[model samples]
Target: MILITGATGHIGSVVLEQLLRKLPAHQLAALVRDEIKAAHLQAQGITIRVGDYRDPASLERAMQGISKVLLVSGGGDEDGLQQHYNVVDAAKKAGVRCLAYTSRALQNPATLTNQLMVRHFQTEDYIRASGLSYLLFRNILYMDTLPQFVGPQVFEKGIQLPAGQGRVAFALRRDMGEAIANVLADDSCQNRIFTFTGAATYSFTDVAQALSELSGRPVEYTPIEEQEFMSRLRAQGLPAVAVERITGFLTDIKNDQESTVTAELADWLGRPPTPLREGIKEIFKV
Candidate 1:
């Protein structure tokens, strides 16, 4: 059976749903923190395995009889790497046929200095030495979350950020999830490194232009100083860790680290990924 960690989360939930369409529920399993909370998954005839990345014993139980696994990357807390280690170790011990991880998509991941990307490298290294066949999905930032970053009033207030002349190849989360689910079910595509990204890259200025075309009104993008942008985000009461993660990514984009476009996601889907304007329109309801 294939096991999906973070089964109730954004990516994992989509992967599970997509898998249900291709495979029987008997061939699927979900690793959840609380079975009570995942009662709906059980209702679909999916075997629910109670587990957490922080608990190696629970992960061990969750891996039993599981032939394949998708280890969805988690937060960048101090314990994050250890949590990944726990899952990898358990999968190794259980003798899983293959293990896959959702890692960062970068032109050069080793060059990224972000805390989250660094931890992903560490986890990837662990998975490599675990003697399990593995696939590393180096996924770019999801356009599914573009609205949260740009905000709801973007059309009126405009975009003011530290990113200047930088672009991101933002793929939809559901597209990535669909590719992963298809891979999980088909052994031929299970074990490979993939740089998952959208068909094209777009800058904040491009976003403004797209918004303008959709709304038939002037939309502006103003570049601001790093400290000022960070201070403004802090003033909004976001947590320090959240602020740090956001700043790190925006800095990468500013430095041209996130502009690389790739076709692997499209190759998996057998068609081009959704365009950025369509995603932006749906995200902002324009």
Candidate 2:
């Protein structure tokens, strides 16, 4: 049986949907922290296992008779490492054959987001050391990231970012989800690391232009210094750590550090990754 953690999340939900199209419902399970939130999935024939990463026994129970497990990274929490470690240990004890992990792109150990990346790296390492067949998917920035950050700005005034002229290889979350589903469905994808990204690269200015054309408004791109941007975000009641993490990501874009799009995603999905313009149109609908 194939099990998916974080099944209620954005990419995980999409992954589940795509997987259901290719695999039998009885062969699938979802490890969810909240049974109430996952009631709809249960109704759809998914075996819902109520468990949290913090509880290893619960994970062990959930992994019973599970063959493959997709481990989606959790959000920043005080016990993130402990929770992830518990899941890994439970998976090992449960004798899961194939393990898949979702990680971030451009995860250099020196960056501010390094802590988050380290957790993923650690999980990958543990899975490898467990002698289990594994696939590590280092994913690019989600296309929804733009709408999440820039949509409000566009609605209020315009898109403002510190990403100057640098381009990013951003993929839609659905594309990432589909890629993961493809990998999980293929028994041949063992002990592999797939770096997934969009089919094309785009800059912040290009994003602004797209928003302007779609919304029929003057969506300007304002490039600001990293410190100033962080200060503004902090003033808006964002945590200092969150501001630093987000600003570091923007700085990476500004430095041309995230512009790597490969054919690997398409090869896995048997289709091209979503284009930036098309993704924007889906979000804006104009």
Candidate 3:
């Protein structure tokens, strides 16, 4: 049986849904913290196991009788890496043969300099040291979140950021979930690192053009200084961590770290991913 952690999350929820179409219900289980949110999944005949990465016993119990696990990386905290460690250790103790992890795409200097990326890299290192067969999914930025980073003023104020002429190969979250499901079901992905990304790369200016075409407005890409961007985001009452994570993405893009496009996602899904324009329509409902 395969257990999917973070089963109620943006990626895991869809991953579970897609996996059900291919694997039997008896062959799948979801590790979720909220039973109420997971009721629908249980109704679909999937096994629901209450667990949290911070709770090792819960993870151990969830891993019982599970042969493989998809360890979706945690978020929203500085101590998130510790939570991931708890899951990895519990999975090792549970004797899970194959463990697949969701990691960020590798940057060009192979450096984990970004605070957020550093935490993910630390988790990857710990997973490698756990001695379990593993598949490291180095996922690129999700296009679904492009609107969020573009802020609430993209139509009227255009796409403003500190990213200057940098590009990102943003894939849809649902498509990535499908690829992760395929990885969990296939043994061939074991002990491999898959760099999952969209087939095409786009700069912030290109994103502005796409928005202009979709919204029938004069959307522009405005580049600002890093401090000014942070100050503006902070003025909007966003938390420091949230500001850092959002701006970190633009910083990485500015440095040309997230521009790599790959065919692996298409290879896994047997189809082309959703185009940026289509994804924008879906997210903005325009």
Top candidate by lDDT:
1
lDDT of 2 at 59: 96
Q: What's the lDDT for all of these models?
A: 0.87, 0.83, 0.86
Each candidate's TM vs. the true structure?
A: 0.95, 0.94, 0.95
Q: Compare candidates 1 and 2 on lDDT and give the better one.
A: 1
Candidate 1 CA-lDDT value = 0.87
Off by over 4 Å in 1: 189-191
Lowest lDDT 10-mer window, candidate 2?
107-116
Off by over 4 Å in 3: 109-113
In TM-score terms, candidate 3 sits at 0.95
Residues 1-286, candidate 1: write the lDDT tens digits: 9999999999999999999999999999999998898899999999999998988999998899999999999976678899999999999888888999998877667666455878887888999898889989888889887777677888789888888888899888999999888778886534588888999999989989888888887889998888898898899998987887788778788877778788889988888999989987886678
Worst 10 residues of 1 by lDDT: 106-115
Worst 10 residues of 3 by lDDT: 106-115
lDDT string, candidate 3, 73-103, tens digits: 9886767889999999999999988888898
